[model samples]
Target: MCAHITDSVLYRHLWGTDETHALLDDGPRVQRWLDILAALAAAQAEVGLMPDDAARAIADHADVALLDLDDVAAETRACGHSTLGLIRCLRRVLPEPAREWVYYGATVQDLTDTWTALVLRDVGALVARELADIEQAARTLAQQHRDTVMPGRTHGQPGLPITFGFKAAVWAAELGRHRARLTEGRRRWEVAQLGGALGTMEFWGDAALPLLDAFARRVGLAAPDVPWLTARDGVAEFVNLLALITATLGKIGQEVYALQRPEIGELAEPVTTGQVGSITMPHKRNPELSEHLVTLARLVRSDASVAVEAMVVEHERDGRAWKTEWAIVPEVCLYSHTALRLAHTLLDGLRADPDRMRANVDAHGGYLVSEPVMRALAARIGKHAAHEVIYEASLAGRERGVDLRTALLADSRVTAHLKADDIDRCLDPEAALGAARSFVDRVAGEA
Candidate 1:
């Protein structure tokens, strides 16, 4: 029985995507480990530490389907060692010539960490592709809504006018930075770990360096300068990057969640037939996918925190910290994949309501464009006096629950400097959105 939500049959979709779960599942992970074993055997043969014939057989018969996982689990319980049981089960299935060389000269960390390198290599590529898709979706939103004006809220109050395109461009610009980070951090985190016990390859003698290079080439990873037995920073860094990516997705989700509110009604996530938002409330149209992105982000961040805590490992081969990564690393990768996938979906079908945006902006009764009026009044009267006149009129209008036009018209001070037409021009929210269109164009062009 699976106790974790990521493995639970009912709640797994809420925690991870199908693609992500497949990558992090026990069977696939074990196959990747077998791949590392095969590479290790081949690398040892390249350096003359093991016979080439044995290495070839190990590589040929490294399929996980041949070994009974139930027996492997039983051996793991009886032997009280992590990789030994795996090696014992693996050895039993290999041809007589290759059985002894199946895991030649490699420790548990060597196989697991090398598998981590492959995980990063594959997962990093997947993340970059999906995130680029997210950027493209945001770019489309920015381009489509370049002139769609909306209220810019500050502290939960409408402060000024801004186009919806500008908001989307900000998201695209941030996604671009994440792409840069992933590209730059790839080589640093994709190096293979080949250190034997005590961070030295004592078993392979002088063939150690050559074996390391061969193993890395065989596994399609970079050769590490030194073993990372106690140095868990690479794992920490990978998970941290995942955490940051998920955080950005969380921000996007939060924005959609808030905007999909009945009171706001400016944006909504895509809905499908037979997908109920609530069991009892039939009228509720909830942001299920967007909300789940936020949930997945929180879970990834928690896993990243554990990765950081794992960095404090003591001495060489500290099982306490390194072992934590056996779960934490896979969790971060899985949760991050789910978050990115959901973000792509949420952005793809995002519904932007320009009519509601205009209505929301106008609901403030011209007060939202107060800055434009203040600037216009400033050109005539001294800046301080203009501020005082408009400030007093705005307060009176709010108190009387009337538009700024009526309040300004009733004030002799305002009337002396500005006509009704001039005030109307200044009160237009569309006129107040300065440089918003240009900003969208700039970000979209760069993307």
Candidate 2:
């Protein structure tokens, strides 16, 4: 059964995405643990810790479907331990000779953390692909609307003229930073975990380090120089990185949601058939997808906090903190996955209402071009003095319900610099979008 959003089934559509569910679900996770055990067995054999034939047999038969998950769960609760249940289940499938060597000297952190590395490797790839989609989408929009003039708002008020391309470029830049984050952060995260009891390989002796390297190579992860049994900074850092990624996506989502308001009408999400926004309000086209991006970010951030807070663990192995990770890590990965995927789709189909953008700029009556006008007049008057003059005029204009240009025209101080035509030209919103296309070209070309 799918997860529910709320008490009302009508709004349950935004509960979760299929991709997120798959990434965090029980069956896939169990399968991953089995795969890790198989790799460990093969690597152990190479290091002369186990027989080659036994290792091969263990690798050949470590199938999740072959074991009963219900039994695994039951044993897990009955034993009150992490890998014991899974180990016992796998033992049932192995011959007596192989059963002793199935897991060998590995610990729970070794299995679970390595599995986390595997998931991180895959999750990073998925996030990169989706972020690229969003980046390309924003690029296309930036290029398409290179000259589409709109008001650049500050403090939720129209402040200056800027092109739609410039706005998209800013978003693209932020997403570019996210891409850089994932690229650099992956190396630090996708490291193997194979430390025995108390961060020492005492149980396996001389064969421990070699076996760990072989296992990591077999599993496509880098062998860490030291064990991270109690040192969870890497896990916390990785989760925090995901939190930053989700926050960036949330920023994009919030912008779209705010711009999609009917009164603003600057942008709208792509409307799909059979997708109802509201039942009570017939005339509704809510930014549901973008809003959910924000929601997913919040959930991922909460999970990240748990992971970070868990970093202050007791010596060697703290079940209190490590067990928290068992719950939080997957949760963060799941929602962060959803956020990235949804952000890609939403950005790909985003509709930039250039006409409405222009209309809004025009409706603001030259108020948005105050910065350019002020800058132009700064050459005539001192910068601070000119700012004061323009500030007063702007406030008066708003109070009297007159255009900013009109107020400036009546001001003797501003009139001393130039004529009415110069003011009009300076106030043109499209004329003030400085080097937006150049920036778009630079970033897009690099991408």
The candidate that achieves the highest TM-score relative to the unseen native structure? 1
Give candidate 2 misplaced runs (Cα > 4 Å): 1-20
Clashes of each: 0, 0
Provide the lDDT at 277 for model 2: 78
TM-scores for the candidates: 0.96, 0.94
User: What lDDT tens digits, residue by residue, belong to model 1 across residues 1-447?
Assistant: 788988998888867777767777878888888888888888888889999999898888889898888888899899999888889988888888888777776788998888887888889988999999999999999999999989888887778999999999999999999999999998888999998887798888999899989999999999989988888888888899999999999999999999889899999899888888789999887789888888888988888989999989788889999899989877888788888988998999999999999999888888888888888989988789889988999999889989888888988998898898999999888789999999999999994
* Angstrom error at residue 64, model 2: 1.2
Q: Over the stretch 201-319, how does candidate 2's per-residue lDDT look in tens digits?
A: 88888998898899999999999988888778878888888898899899889999999999899988887898887999988877988998999899888889888888899988998
Candidate 2 pairs with clashing backbones: none
Top candidate by lDDT: 1
**Worst window of 10 by summed lDDT in candidate 2:** 4-13
Badly placed stretches (over 4 Å) of model 1 are 380-388
Candidate 1 to truth, TM: 0.96
